[model samples]
Target: MEGSRRRTTAPRARPAATRPTREAGGTAAALPDAGSHGPPRGARSRRGELDGAPAETPRARAAPRRAPARPRDTQPPATDGARAAERPAVPEPQPPADPEAPAVARRPSSRRGGRSTARQPRAPRRSRRERDQLMDVLHALRLRRQETCVSANTVNTVVTRLLRGLGNRESEFEGVEQLNTGSYYEHVKISAPNEFDVMFKLEVPRIQLQEYYDSGAFYLVKFKRIPRGNPFGHFLEGEILSATKMLSKFRKIIKEEVKEIKDIDVTVEEEKPGSPAVTLLIRNPEEISVDIILALESKGSWPESTREGLPIQSWLGTKVRTNLRRDPFYLVPKNAKHGKGFQGQTWRLSFSHTEKYILNNHGTEKKCCESGGVKCCRKACLKLMKYLLERLKQEFQELDAFCSYHVKTAMLHMWTQNPQDSQWEFTNLSFCFDKFLMFFIECLRTEKLDHYFIPKFNLFSRELIDKKSKEFLLKKIEYERNNRFPIFDKF
Candidate 1:
């Protein structure tokens, strides 16, 4: 082994790049030094040397050249090597052991008092005060809105008496049961509870649905097997249920019952074209309106258009969605905008029940928004949006086509986009409300807000809202947004 060993002299000093650095933690860490790029300081350049020929040092080579003198107080401009030498070497950050863990922020260099020198951004001036004032205004508006809502006891008492009279007088309407629906029952009602949507649902046997319009919203209802002694036999026109005739008969029965209740001053309002509700104007103690919608409850499967919609797997859960879909859907006596041919035969599909359930139990977690659980500003955001729409409608009568339902649909879609409970934290009310408004404004700009249940159906289509009106509404909304919603001040 000694004979095979090659001659060896004093070992050359290990390069500074391989030297250990004493870190602030009192640990010697091996790090590549700044001078690793070239020969060590005071060493001659080996770039052109051959066979041990004499080489020139950097300072010796530059000694012949002279540069302009700067001010005495000004130091010489730093070279790349000098700058690198001054900067402490930092290792490339190692990723977290858990890939899903959030990344750690890199430490600021020690040169700038351990602070970032790239202009630390100052927080928005008066932002907290503005947000606080906005929330206070919203809370006041909500209280005022609550005051406008008609008393629940008063509504129940009047509806109970009216329905009882209808059941006793009309045998055909005996099976009709009340299904509370709409924004009022959903607990998002603003302005007044004087307006109520009560669906008079009549259970129907197995039925087939055919799309009446391309929108898949209006449908033609047909019974597979007409039951014997079906009171609706007269309301049928060539095997298809006549929504017009049935609704007219329903209106007549309700009108007769209203006359019987002389104690309460109630009068059926004149029927509006294309409206399915038989509106009742009550003027005994307060001026209140009740919209009695005639609906057909069907236990059959939902239409094919809804197959790709209701994306609630990541939000409300797939099992919850499936269970909700199993519940009966209603067919209101609502016809298309241009229902010239089949004016009285069309029925619009109503998912008011699903909407109510989703709103009432809206949360990713079971205890979310409940007592002792994390509260969210979802409902508050919705109310503010609704109130915004209401105020805008008052200013611009052209926005009559835009209703509270449009706002509700936008919010549901917003939930799917932002599913985290933390995003809707109640403490961040102003932030969440602004986010929701921006989403709604985007929908208005695109002129394409999809129906919650039917993806193919565009609620903001030209048929429902003209392009000119939408453009005008967009400007108004943007103006309100930029001005911190001055319209909300009216409330």
Candidate 2:
């Protein structure tokens, strides 16, 4: 037996590669395959207890005792039943048993039957972008200008005209008296809210003119100062009351209550809000009211001891500033209306129709009834008549009327150049000055010229400075003064 056991141990010592091939017909090969078929020792203990080697314990094998099934329909709902009755409380909900069908996910809850699902989180909100730096800068600059209030430039042309509209209306309120300080002034101040103690101090900047043709940038300027009642108050109140009347009356007369008049960008602000305290309203047209205000203040108003002319004539020559002259670009030969590109002639005809409609009508009776305020805006009226004259000149093939204006301007220039040698010679240019003046004055009287003639001609009369020329002009102007054209009244 010892020898046999030694042989068995000796065989096991050889590697399986050398001993266990089926070709060698070794029993070790059969042993290995048998071992593969059976479970390992530990695996058998786990599997066998329930399924393979060992039988189940009597306790585990014994079938569990299930309680009797309840009749669902006959049973009262948990809410209707007594607390802690037959079935403890809520029946636990069971998931359906089909594998192919999707399972409804249940949320956990402390209560026996309750379930709560979690909610999805929302995305975060984004912040808004800040305002543009340039816009903020501009706004700051404007506010600073307002705070400083060194802008006498606020009292524009129409402001002055509106004031003129108040001519003598404020005379009842005007009387010069020296008023005291703030506390003292306030103590004397009347309690009536209806009555405003008016005052206006316009520090009109000396008009700055770069050239005859440069268009400066539009300025939305404002001004402010303390109350200086008497004359200043009169001026301020006159301007505001007049301005309000001007705009309101304009809308009323024109029947254009809603027309925005867009080409005219406008804003009228008072430093002290309503009625009067250093008020300013501005409109930026190709040319604006400030220019007119300057003109009126300078050449149109009663003579000024402190200042000579309105800023209009002060900035530009009287001839250039007044609405007297025609647009040089809008020129056309007489009978030129029939040509292919005669916009000038057409423009003139347009003005002619507009003027006739405005001047001939009793009041707001013409076509374009919506624009009846056309008559009230002397500038518009003048502009219309201006074109009409051009049309009449083209229709008659006689633009010599305009030539006469050129001649008059040229004559004054020449007379100024050499005052001693200056003399009227109607023979050399038998477009005689007198005859030209005669036809020119007639043209001015045409419904087209009605609006612009008086103001323009008066300026000419006032500005003709040569003594010899003045004397000669006076002889022709014998019946008039201030170089006023005798023919203007006749026209």
Candidate 3:
């Protein structure tokens, strides 16, 4: 190994594709030192003779021109020199790791003194004065409507409240009082465990209602399940459905029941700004003239008539006919004061809905109810007539059928049974010895037959009627002689 020796030298540098930039001389280019000349400046004479080539300009040294960009599908010519170059020498740029920070601090356009305040919205706040103003308007409206709707019940309540002293309820509301409406949520509003919507409703306590009616101050009272709520609030969430439901029910009632109205004149109202109401006026064609219907079903005896005493209420026909019925459908009630209670409640008679007696005339075999001097009685016919008239006024065919046809069928069925048993109960039982016949005459077959009523043959009318074959009328009014009695009716 020591004996082998070799010398190596780098290959000669080739001309670059581009020319090098000339370095600037600090002062001036010196002429080559006298004996050390390399080659003439900017001349290629001696170096060019070694290669035997002519000298070229810098522009001529660049790579030869190539074709323009081709579509990728075309093949490019292979080159061994480029493929043999293993490593890429050029470097690519890199991105910064921290991108958020700004390269330079910026001076704000507006200075501290010129800055604007931030804005925000606030909740509404009404003052005491504003609240009082609103309440005043509402209170005034309520007070104005009260006078017209002054129910006897309410009037009585006012009177009672006055007598008992309303505690501090009389004081006017102060402006400083602040109420949070949301507090009701905590106050325990509840639907009653009871199915009824009301614990009790405001109602007239004393008077009872009749179908064909009479008018006067009346008071009502009853127990019901009322909702728990703040009485002060006009409408609360829990009560909204209640008020709506109540009005719906009332409208349904108007659609169903009620009869003719001969006259309606009312200035009174039940609510402020007047919502609809259940108002009825006395439009009855028949008016009750009798003070009472004398019915005696009581264990207690009827009061003996005394000249100096108060008139005894005498209803002769009505008696307690059934056991006490809890059902609402069976019959209406009469108070114990009506008559002393018997097995059931003793029935006391009222001329309340009765108008005048429905007197039917029958042919006289000298028969009569023996109500001397024509006892003018009041009856249900007037009520029925009034109801029919109201229906006619409203032009309601449905109501007309309900009252005149359906309701009357039920009532006629009721009244036709047992009837009043009027004679024996009212008069002495001994007085019924005279044939027990009610004299009925003049039955009208047509609604237009008011001008002419054909006579009905009662025992009395049978004798009075002389039915001859000719001309079909009585020749002379005949008489079955109970002729001994004075003919007071003849006049």
RMSD (CA, Å), each prediction: 19.7, 45.2, 52.0
Put down candidate 1 lDDT per residue, 1-491, tens digits, no spaces: 11111111212233334322211111111111111222212212223331123333333222222432322112123343344454445432211122211111122233221111224322122145546766776666553544454455566666787678877764667878889998778878766666788888889878999897576898888988887987778989998998898889989988877777766677899999889999988774777788989889998788887776776766788898899888888899998777344467889989998999999888887888889998778898898888888889998998988988899988887776555565566655654565565556557756778888887788988877898888777778756765667786677
Residue pairs with backbone atoms closer than 3 Å in model 1 (clashes): 149-193
Task: Write one digit per residue (lDDT tens) for candidate 3, span 1-491.
Answer: 00001111112132223111110111011111111122211112221121122323223232233333222112123342243243232111112212211111111223111001112111122223322432332233232333323332332332233223322233211111111111011111111110000011112112222211111111111113233452323322232212323333333332222222113221112322112223232211221110001111112211121111111111112121121111111111222121232111211122111211212311021133345532211112222222322333254332221122222222222222213233112111111111111000011000010000011112112222222311111110011112211121121
Error of 3 at 491 (Å): 27
The residue ranges of model 3 lying beyond 4 angstroms of the native Cα positions read: 1-217, 220-249, 252-491
C-alpha lDDT of all candidate models, in order: 0.66, 0.22, 0.20
Better of 1 and 3 by TM-score: 1
Best by lDDT: 1
Backbone clashes, candidate 1? 1
Q: How accurate is candidate 2 locally (lDDT)?
A: 0.22
Q: On a 0 to 1 TM-score scale, where does candidate 3 land against the true structure? A: 0.15
**Error of model 1, residue 376, in angstroms:** 0.5
Using lDDT, rank the candidates from best to worst.
1, 2, 3
> Which of 2 and 3 is the better model by TM-score?
2
Top-down TM-score ranking? 1, 2, 3
